[model samples]
Target: MQIYWTKINKIIEETPEVKTFLLDCPEGYTWEEGAHIHLALEGFNAGDKPNRRLIRHMSISTLPNENSIGITTRIKEQCSEFKAILRNLDVGDEMAIFKTHSNVPLKREDKNVYLLSSGVGLATFRPLVLDYFERADNVNKIHSLNVDSSKDFLFTNIFESAPDKKFASQFVDNRKDYYEEVKNLAADKDGLFYVVGSDEFLVQNIEVLLEQGIKPDQIMLDKHARQLPEFLSSDLSI
Candidate 1:
């Protein structure tokens, strides 16, 4: 695989525990909305084999037209070794990115789109929203529902109710309310449902969506093809 080394342009603190690292876009590096990259720390390639702890698969929160590649994530006090190292890195620090791919790209099939996410998982949907706003030719409308118990919502500027723009967004702080909203959104059986969150969160949403009579094909997930059948199984019966 071709690896591209890039420098950090700046960092934006989106919330107390969340930050967006804006990296310099390398020449000839282009990716679609909802793309993710394997970010490797400085010491990742020191030995013959890469250090697993130094690499992380992060979503590209910004679009290629945005001029910078943004990786937005939450860093807690007791976080993983990779996040700890990442939090300490300063501007101009070089990092390696490779194996770029997108599991969830904007699918404009002339139908409504619903984005369901938990906390920082919304980072994966940022670009898709932006893409829709830029030119929503085949899309009908877009609605975003994010559950961040922190209450400090991210990207409030981008995610707002705009009738003219054909977009609306809502934030819920609790699971009970979030799932209720999910059920409500699932009423539109023909709408495309894109979900991003922890495995538990994904399973919970999938269960609720399936129970609501939404088909497996109408739901979009970041999981690979090999891993999708397990999630769509009857074992997730709620």
Candidate 2:
């Protein structure tokens, strides 16, 4: 892992709680589509350490050819302090990135892929979804199921290129049925299942997928901001 520093170039608010930060990709700095980088704030406090550099893992939102590193994050009440620091950052503000790391290969096997995301989990998978259409060959039916509590969907226009395929469900009429709906989405069960979401989302759906007879290797995970449940709370390192 290598450390890199870059200044903020632009910030765009996609939703009230979600924002995307653009950073000038450093010289010779490169990363994969679904790669992730860590952000560290200088004066963040953790325990009694005033100089504690609070760090968080964020997914790279934009494609590699976009010329800049884009980070999209949601400011929740729990991490308000850290998100507030990032939210108030303006253009030219200094940002420290520890490194970009992703072992996910860029190869595919002509199998249908189901991108499953809930809430801010969309941050990690959006770039992968974009990469799928842009890079992979023999790509089969790519389905995206994005669920949010209210009708305020995050990436409404981002995935609009495929009108019939991408499905965004604002759980208003079907407020509490998103989980069940996910099961329905998995019915066809074609190829790879790339699951990105909170711990609860991973634990619940992964169990369902496994019970549905999907192999462990066929399920890929991009667990952001978590460790234990991120790994299924099992011995599985992935």
Candidate 3:
């Protein structure tokens, strides 16, 4: 992987616990939709040792435009390094980034596209969504389902106004039945589905989709955690 030093341009808080960082990339740097880059955090205190933290597999949260790119991250703990570094990041500070890469090819000419995401999984789908909006003759139908644990949903206005067939957001609390709500939503359409989230999140939703009659081939999932046994079942084979 090729590494480059980029400057942090700006950081915006999308929610109470989430922030989006805008980076100024080097001239002529380009990346495709769904690609991910690595960020190296050195000189950070990791327990007793002065260690380096490398965050690979971070998704590009926006299109590279005017020599800049964006990444959105969620704050896990109050004292976490990820939160500390991001909160204190400045405009001129330099950060190391590896070249972008992805196994998924997001170039779809189909008029219908469904984007389903939870938490920071939206970052993986941001570039593709932006490209669809930027094209001059783009008349494709885009449907986005953003699932969150509460009412403070991220990017609500942006996705609501985004050009598409439909846009919806569902907030689930642990006390509520999340599976039933998601199952009802997934049954509304039979189109290309892109699912991204934690492994448990993906597994639960994917099973709900399949139980509701969505074909395995029609559903594509990208999760941060390792694959679960449910996802590895033979029934998923085409």
Best by TM-score: 1
Best by lDDT: 1
Candidate 1 stretches greater than 4 Å from native: 234-238
Model 3 weakest lDDT span, ten residues long: 162-171
RMSD of each: 1.0, 4.3, 4.3
What lDDT does candidate 1 reach at residue 13?
97
lDDT of 3 at 26: 76
lDDT of 3 at 233: 62
The TM-score of candidate 1 is 0.97
- For model 1, residues 1-238, the per-residue Cα lDDT tens digits are 9999999999999999999999999999999998999999999999999999999999999999989999999999999999999999999999999999998998989999999999999999999999999998999999999999999999999988898989999999999999999999999989999999999999999999999989888889987778888887777766
- Which is better, 1 or 3, measured by lDDT? 1
Model 3, 163-204: lDDT tens per residue? Answer: 343434344444145565656557656567777787777776
**Which sequence of candidate numbers ranks them by TM-score, best first?**
1, 2, 3
Shift of residue 231 alpha carbon in model 1, Å:
1.4
Location of the lowest summed lDDT over 10 successive residues in candidate 2:
166-175
In model 1, state the lDDT of residue 30: 94
